[model samples]
Target chain A: MISILKNWVRGSNKLERFWLLSKIEYKLRYYENKLGLVWALIKPLSEIFIYYIAFEVIMKAGIPHFVSYLFIALVLWNFFVESSLGTIQILATKKYLYEYTNMNKIEIYLSVIGSNLIGLFFNILMFFVYYIFIEKGMYVSWHIIFLIPIVLNLVILSLGFSLILSNLYIIAKDIQQIWLIIIGLGFWISPILYKLDTFRAALPGLEYINPISNIIINARNVVLYNHVPEWGLLFWGLIYSVFFLLIGLYLLNRLGSKAAEKL
Target chain B: MELNKEKVAVIARNISKTFYISEDSYNTVKKRLFNLFNTPKPKEVAALKMMNFQIDRGECFGLIGRNGSGKSTLARVLAGVYPTDTGYVKINGSTMLMNLGVGMSHELTARENIYVSGSVLGLKIKEIDKVFDKIVDFAELREFIDTKIKFFSSGMIARLGFSIAVNAGAEIMFLDEILTVGDIKFQEKAIKVFEKSWIDGKTVILVSHSMDVIKKYCQRVAYLKNGVLEYLGDAETAVNMYIAENK
Candidate 1:
């Protein structure tokens, strides 16, 4: 424990390095494009618009504040997809960072998640803007502070999944293709466009089985529905994510030694 | 010369690394399923055989061998980049490896590369800010500081990388052919830096084919031949052994 504290003091420099690298990574993504950072808002807004048209206009789900409801789900889910999927090949792609310098492996994973997080922050801000001015949902309340832990949960979950996938990728390149299919199927299963209650009613065990489903339900309840979050589901979601993270870190420690040599 | 704990900068004990390369790599579920009953045995390549060595603090050590001789592997193992398969390596201080600038992102500008590499080497932003101009000036990339390094020539890239290492280097540096690139003028400048200012009190493990460099800078040299430590003694004997084996 004392060693960890000592490391924290020594690690101030590492944290700074992590922030700088992540910022550069965030900038480099849109460095060549003329639209630049506007793309961050454009990509998600277009997705939301398409879903808005399909579910609300065509299907007429008749859920009040449907746009805000869908917005919260998509923003959180997209962060999971983008962060976890982006880091699958991180061991090979970011080999230079650890291979050449005395960088801790955790920092490499943090930087990838960090860049995606910058995008998530922007989308969350846009969600608030739409909620206040455009959608004008009458649900804003003190419960909004709950978004902090919710976002932290998402970040940890994504970081955990990425750690597992990136290390596994060194062994089998097919994990990428396999994960793509899983994520595609995962989107529809996770109550993104539809109401969580409808999903739980239909699937019955989705709230317990799918962490994303729980997150979306709780997030919408707090933000869109103006109700207290489902604490039991929220706790379950945290447990699932932390569990995945621990397993992922263990896999990395075991398989990550071959990273520099293989990649 | 009495060998003591205080004088040692690096120590390797019975270290070995073996890599298993698949004959026909199967990374997907379908291929794995098809081959489940008939899995092909992987071919093993022992990159480093049982090796033991100790490097003293402030000493310049030379590693010389032919291609695939495990010089690079030993350097990496010693640098803690690759894990040793059987034994362990202990390093006293932080380490940085330079091989034609491995960490510089081509997407970033030279200025950004300095910050990235400097930060990775454990320099604070303020410390990097102080030495930023020196890195640019030494590399003679003042004009192309903001230009993406992908546009820069290989020589310019190498110069930029070497300059960063010179300015914001770790205590222990593993130089893997950093001097082989760049033009004659830059090479001369690099040699001057090594001679006058660089190797004064730093631990350097230089991996190069140039016997002249090995003879000049290294007080002791390790000659590896096919993953085996063939010689570890005075630079003159190792250089002669390497030259004789080349014939």
Candidate 2:
């Protein structure tokens, strides 16, 4: 546990490094585009619009505030997808540091996640703005306080999966292709466009097992529905989060030093 | 005169390293499983032999060898960049490896690279900020500090890399062919900084094919002949051994 937070006490310089690198990464990602930072919001907004047109207009979905609902889910899912995929490929792009310098291995992944967090922050803030003013469903409730821990827990969980994927990616170059397929399947598996209750009502036991579905449900209850998240489910989510985090830490410790040599 | 062994800055013992250079092994699960039942083809290239050496604090050590003689590998192993296959390396203080473009991103500005590169060398961002001006001044790229590095010339990049590594406050420095980079003026400026580091008593492990540099900068030198430590004593003997073997 201390090992995870050890970067902090080791110095805030690492935190600054993460921030600086993440900023450059975030900028480099979109600086080439003519649209600049507007491209960041354009991705999820267009995604939300397309989903709205598909399920709401064509299928005539009965859910109220469907655009807002889809926006929240799409934004969060985009973060997850970008983060995991970014984590997998990040080492190859940033291998210069390890090959040429003495950088710690975990710093690469942390910066990847940090870049995603920058994007996610804007997306979440936009959702809240659309929720409180333009949309009628959510108010600034005390339940929103739980959004902090909820998102953090999900980030940890996603990082765990990414850590495992990154190590695997080093050995297997085509892991990204396989991971892309898994992520595509994962989108429909998680409760994003459809309501979480539909999943719970349709398949009672499976929702409890899928951590992705659980995070979406818990997040929706606090941010979208403004209902208290299920504590029992969150407790399980926390357990899985911790479990994946431990796995990631172990793999990174083992494979990190060897990463440069293997490359 | 013998240096104080108790104040050793780096100790490398029987360090051996091999690279799995064979491309026959499957990288994917499907491919790996298809060939699982078959006997695996194994091939390895030994980069370093069972080399043992120790550098006391304040020693300027040079490694000289022909191309692919594992001089860079030995320097990297000593810097803890590559792990030894069969032995251990112990470094007593903060270390930096000085290579071409070292750890800076070309997409970033010189100012931007300073912060991240400094942090990569284990310096705090605040500490980096304090030396930021000094780095730019040392690099002689004051006019181009905010300019994106991709726009800079090769000489400018080398200057920036040298400035950061020298100012990173690492006690032990591993330099690999970095002295050969850039123009004559930049090299002269870098040698001045290096002379200062020597006076300040920093431990330096310099790997260069230039005999004049090894003779001028190194008090003691080691010559590696195909990953074997052929000579490890005075600079003159090592340089002579290197010249005799190469010719």
Candidate 3:
């Protein structure tokens, strides 16, 4: 713990830099658009609407409180998808930052993920607003606090994939298309628009393999169901995130040395 | 101002760098599958080969070479942008490479660019705020502060880049072809700034094609010929060597 504190103090400068770069990234993303900030909300909202039309109206999943249920999981999942995909080309795109300055390579990944986190926060805020007005009889509970760790888990998981994929992307550009297929399948595999128990029986040990599954499960438990998170699953999810993060950071340090040269 | 010749600021020992240019990159799995038995070997280009040099603290050192002579590569290696293949570079102070429009996002405004590049230089936002006005004033870009740099001329961009390096730069600065851009007036202003206060107690590694700017400021110069240090001594001899080699 003391070491962690020491690292935080030492990293105060990097943290400050990360915050500024992320803000620039988030702003620059919508800089040219007329709607600007509103586009952040529009993306996830539109995704939820389309999924709702397909799952609830047409297919008739008929779970409970479908909108909020899907919104909670979709918001978390979108952050992972967007952040990882956005970062695949980050080392090449943001070469200017590190090529001339003494900026650490990890900071580039942080800024991109941090920008996605901003979008995630905005969508979560919209989720709460929806919960209050649109969804009736759902009481606010302390279980909501669990969303913090769940969100952090999602961020870490996305950062892991970002680090790994971006490093591979420097070597091979085809990781982009391959990752798209993976995430498309991942979207269906997780309980985003479907029931968890149905897939849990079919694909045993999925929560352990797919960290997003555990995160979605925990998020829904805390926000919608008002139940405490499955502690076992939370522990496993944390393990998976950390495991991925360690490997990603390792690959970044090892294979990412030729990043500037390759790009 | 006399520099502190006692303390060493930058040191490079037997460093070399080689780049591999692959004719065919099997980026996709399909390409990899089809070419499973035989893969194309990458062609090697030796950017720098067995080079060694050191600069004292606050020394105005110049690096002169013809195009593709590894001057920029050596500068980058010393600036810690590119790692050497064989040896290491030990820099005693913070370093910044002031290449052409480097670290400046064309899509960002001058204000935003300043903050981004400043932060990368290890300055906190509050710290940048203190030096913000001075940077804009020195660049003579007060009016275009909020405008995106993409709309600005290359000369204006160079001025902004130079100003940022002057104000918010590191202790050890690698200036790569910074004088090539900008108008003659701005170049004169930049030369004046360098002469007046910028070079005081700062280790500057200047890479330039202009012999006049180099001869004026450099106490010593290193002339590189095709990745090898051909000459390292007085500025006049090195400049003459580079010119004669060109002919």
What is the clash count for each candidate, in the order shown?
0, 0, 0
lDDT of candidate 2 over B1-247, digit per residue (tens)? 3435569998887789987765675677778767878846668788888988899898889989898898888888888887788979888766777778677777788988888777777777778889999999988999988899999988889888888887774678888887766789878877787788653678888888788888888988988888888889999999988888867
lDDT tens per residue, model 1, A22-108: 999899886569999998888888998998899889999887788788888889998899888888988887787889865678888
TM-score on alpha carbons, each prediction = 0.95, 0.90, 0.92
Residue by residue across A50-72, what tens digits does model 2's lDDT show? 88888889998778878877887
Q: Which CAPRI tier for candidate 3? A: medium
lDDT of 3 by residue, A1-263 (tens): 99998887676567788889999999988656899988888888899889889988999988888888888888888888888887888888898888885567998888888888888888889999999888988867998998888888888899999999999887778889999999999988897888888778888887778778999999999998889999999989998999999999998987677787777
- Native-contact fraction for each model? 0.64, 0.64, 0.69
Residue pairs with backbone atoms closer than 3 Å in model 1 (clashes): none
What candidate 2 gets wrong by more than 4 Å, as runs, is A1-12, A30-32, B1-6, B24-26
TM-score of every candidate's chain A = 0.95, 0.91, 0.94
TM-score of chain A of 1: 0.95
The C-alpha local distance difference test score for the whole of candidate 1 amounts to 0.86
Clashes of 2: 0
Report every candidate's CA lDDT: 0.86, 0.80, 0.86
Candidate 1: stretches off by over 4 Å: A1-7, A10-12, B1-6
Residue B195, model 1: lDDT of: 73
